[model samples]
Target: MEADMSAGDLDRRVQFRRVTRMNTALGQEETWADLGSPVWASRRDVSDGEKAAAGGVFSTVSARFQIRSSTFSRGITAKDMLTCDGREWEIVGIKEIGRRDRIEITATARTDR
Candidate 1:
């Protein structure tokens, strides 16, 4: 039988569309245009290590890619921040962590996409 898609459902079976991005401070809110592709993962709480990269040297250190819904809200267990159009924004929380509502994502200070 075929299964359908659900919100926040990480289906390892079908390989969900995980969009990884290198978060950072841009001076304002973020947008899909600013977000990188393939979903770069955060190096984690640690300061150094390998993660993921998009449009740069493959050897470049990877950035963080926390969950972000197009709609902004609060309640997500993990704290987040975002940047878009070169502006920085704090992730208050997630109103809905669906791809439809998700948009902005914050990164560590001075980080680049």
Candidate 2:
């Protein structure tokens, strides 16, 4: 089960992307955007629930995936996000089930770059 990371701290975590119907003129799909973060986020933040709360540019579509969090601290971190080999994410915000509840992985999309 995903853990809640609200009271702890929202730091860099994993990134995810989903396919959108929209693509570049060349038909090439742009899944990520440059929002001062190097991690290439997918279409959906998997756990990204609300929009207004996590203010940022986002794609119309999203997807679901699995990831692991820190065991010592026993939680997820942006540094745990992997793209191909191993990548880090700039956690925009964390969606907590409740106070001190297990935090699930959610993210917001930036502009395609």
Candidate 3:
């Protein structure tokens, strides 16, 4: 557990969302839907990197979020996305702290979609 981090440290509110696939007149379309209510979390910048593709360079920013563990948070996975401050992040890693007392999520800024 993060003994030094108190609930007050979780100053930011973030929401989790998952992709929902639906059949359309043309074909299947994927949309995002909220997974649960917003939760308090501490956000911290992790890293910044660049990717090159198709003769272009794209910048990527990664961040880590720490939140108290709960039924809603426990269901979060790499397939889910988190949004805060009007920005969307792609979940990359999840680590349980002290037997699920807390969860640390590593995410990268979404640029592809």
Give all candidates' CA lDDT scores: 0.32, 0.36, 0.90
Q: Number of backbone collisions per candidate, in order?
A: 24, 14, 0
Worst 10 residues of 2 by lDDT: 34-43
| Model 2 misplaced regions, further than 4 Å | 1-65, 69-89, 95-103
- TM-scores of all candidate predictions against the true structure: 0.21, 0.25, 0.89
What ranking emerges by lDDT with the best candidate at the front?
3, 2, 1
Model 1 residue 82 CA deviation (Å) reads 0.9
Task: Give the lowest summed-lDDT range of ten residues in model 1.
Answer: 10-19
Candidate rank order under TM-score: 3, 2, 1
RMSD of each: 14.3, 13.3, 2.1
User: Could you give me the TM-score of model 2 versus the true structure?
Assistant: 0.25
CA error at residue 47 for candidate 1, angstroms:
34
Best by TM-score: 3
Model 2 whole-model lDDT (C-alpha atoms) = 0.36
Off by over 4 Å in 3: 1-4, 110-113
Per-residue lDDT of model 2, residues 1-113, tens digit only: 54433422433344333323456788967454322223322233454333343566543223322232323223444534333223333344444344443344443333232
lDDT of model 3 at position 53: 87
**True-vs-predicted CA distance for residue 104, candidate 1, Å:** 9.1
